[model samples]
Target: MQATRTEEKTAETHGGASSPQPQQRLRDKKVGDLIAGKKRLVEVPYTASLADTINTLVANRIMAVAVAAPPGQWIGAGGSMILESDKQTGAVRKHYIGMVTMLDVLAHIAGNDVAPAVEGGGGGGGELERKMQVPVSTIIGHCLESLSLWTLNYNTSILDCMEVFSKGIHRALVPVDGHLENVGGVELMESASSYHMVTQMDLIKFLKVHEAELRGILTRRVRELGGLTDIVFGVTDKTNVIDAIKCMNSASLHAVPIVESTDEIGDDHGQLVNGKDRKLVGTFSATDLRGCPISQLQSCLHMNIVDFLEKLLDTPQQEACGLRTSTREHITCQPESLLREVVDKAINSHVHRVWVVDGRGLLAGLVSLADIIRMMRVWMLSEPA
Candidate 1:
């Protein structure tokens, strides 16, 4: 996506040689602009079972979804009545209790009590099935670490939205075409209305579209940026899928890097030590379980991570689940790589993160969408007022 080409097309249409400055144009853009023509928000009722919630996420190919409470439940929520769009019925009002992500589901499944049930023989499968039938509301508590869904006005500036995402909130709800009310000087949605879900990827894509204006920052090396996390959580190829999920839940991560097992045994918590020497093999993420049948989830969980990822990629349903075709191959970059390279890889590959490796392809660190957004936020703030 070339901003220059877009500008040229605009120039041709208007017959104007000059237009607003790029930075000023970006600043003037609002959250509404980002979601102008996006599909209506997809939400699951709070009463929906965990299995149903997983179905919705897989069917929609989304990592997270808004969980809505039935109408009239917002009375004492301390805010205006927010509404959500229903595909079957138009204009249904509901209170969005919070957002639920794939990680949350994994966390719930990998909880201490549930792990043993799934790992145990005989009645384990029955226990897992029973747990899957539980209400999705039971898992909302796991979302606390990732923060609850934040509501933003459609008229909010893109920069403001970026600031919110920079704080580690993966997604936010932006009410569109809704009346706003002032509640103690804070703008709140006043009535039932539709909204668009804005994610960190949206902001990254926005930046990618305007890369021409961010050449200075993009040209720098990843090492030059200060937010890269050196401490990475991962599992070995020999680790069971269940243990991998457990590792992700324990570390509060959406994905975990898979490396070749070392002779030195790690601790009981499944955390890999000596991260610098670990060889990058593949990644296991929450999304990998998409399209998996609830009946087979237990069996899948018991398979080796390496074998499971391979079979997952080879399945005909993998494409529908949104797994990249090149998933079998490691998508990675080095610390010396330019930031632009990492951003392009992330956006192009449709992956949330790119594992950073050394010259020998050993796990070095990790760069996430949050890290990229934070870099952009820092750069934006350092600009002249």
Candidate 2:
């Protein structure tokens, strides 16, 4: 995406035919510039049912969507949909409540309160349907508060967005400047002029496009960069899918490593034995639930996570029908690997995080999109004189 205003301003400031340094251009780039080329925002009302919300996410092929307050509560009666501002006094009106993601849905389904109902055999399908009918607002309570929706002003700098994402905020909403429109007593966000969702992937893609200018930072090894940690959370290969989901939900993790361990001596928390030698076998993620039918998911919950993944990947039905499933093989990087390699693996594999391994192929830590962005922010701020 081109940064029209920022580019024009930069070109004007530097003499014609000469461009500003890449670092200066990136620092001056604003959230509005990044979002200017993005598609219109997708949103769901707070009162929308969980089933509707799930359908919307699948239909849009998006992992999350902004949840907004009901119509009249957030906007006034006008035939134009605009930013949350009063037409007369120009005061702000808070419209968006938060974001509801696929993880939230998985957490709700795998929560302690709902697990028993799901495991109870009699009329379980009906119960699952009932749970799906609950309003989307109910799902927000099960999500990590840190993952809640954040807003950024259009003029906010790209560096500021990197800071936020570095702190584990997955996505932020950028409200486009526009007028509020009401149609037949219902406020509607105009397709051409609505909020744009900025994600870590967007920033990563931007970095990739500008990688030529970032050779110095990209060539550095992950170990030398110092973001890698020894602490890693994962589950044993024998862990049940339901228990794995619970562990991830409680920890607010997008994905967890599945390790092979012979020692079963541990609390039945479905986690790997701490301080034991384990080999990275696979992974289970909240994104695995994408496009999964509720009926199919309920049945798979009781299966072993590794078995479930194998079935998901090797099932003839999926392969024959050409269905999209979370079939990505586990991706890993070493501490000695270049940062650019990690970034390329994440973007090319279309995965959120990459596992870090020692020379023995044992789990060490993980590098997420957030971690990469954090490193970039550090590099930008610590550029040598």
Among all candidates shown, the one with the greatest lDDT = 1
The per-prediction tally of clashing pairs is 0, 10
lDDT for each residue of candidate 1 in 274-385, tens digit (9 for 90 to 100): 4555888888778787756676777777777888877676566677777763335887898889999999999887888899999998888889998998898788678775
lDDT at residue 311 of model 1 (Cα atoms): 68
Residue ranges of candidate 1 with Cα displaced over 4 Å? 1-24, 72-92, 112-123, 145-147, 178-192, 265-269, 272-274, 325-327
Off by over 4 Å in 2: 1-24, 71-94, 113-123, 178-193, 264-269, 272-277, 314-328
Q: Tell me each candidate's TM-score.
A: 0.83, 0.79
Tens-digit per-residue lDDT, 1-385, candidate 2: 3788788878788776447765646656777777768987898887899889987876776778877674455431122233455546665554665578877887887764343234446435565677789988767746684234455667667777788878777776666763332111112343223578888898889878877767888999999998675678888877888888888888787778888756555545475444224588887777666545665766777778877877777554444323334434668899999999999998886677888888898888888898899999889878653
- Cα RMSD to native, each candidate? 5.8, 7.5
Best by TM-score: 1
Clashing pairs in 1: none
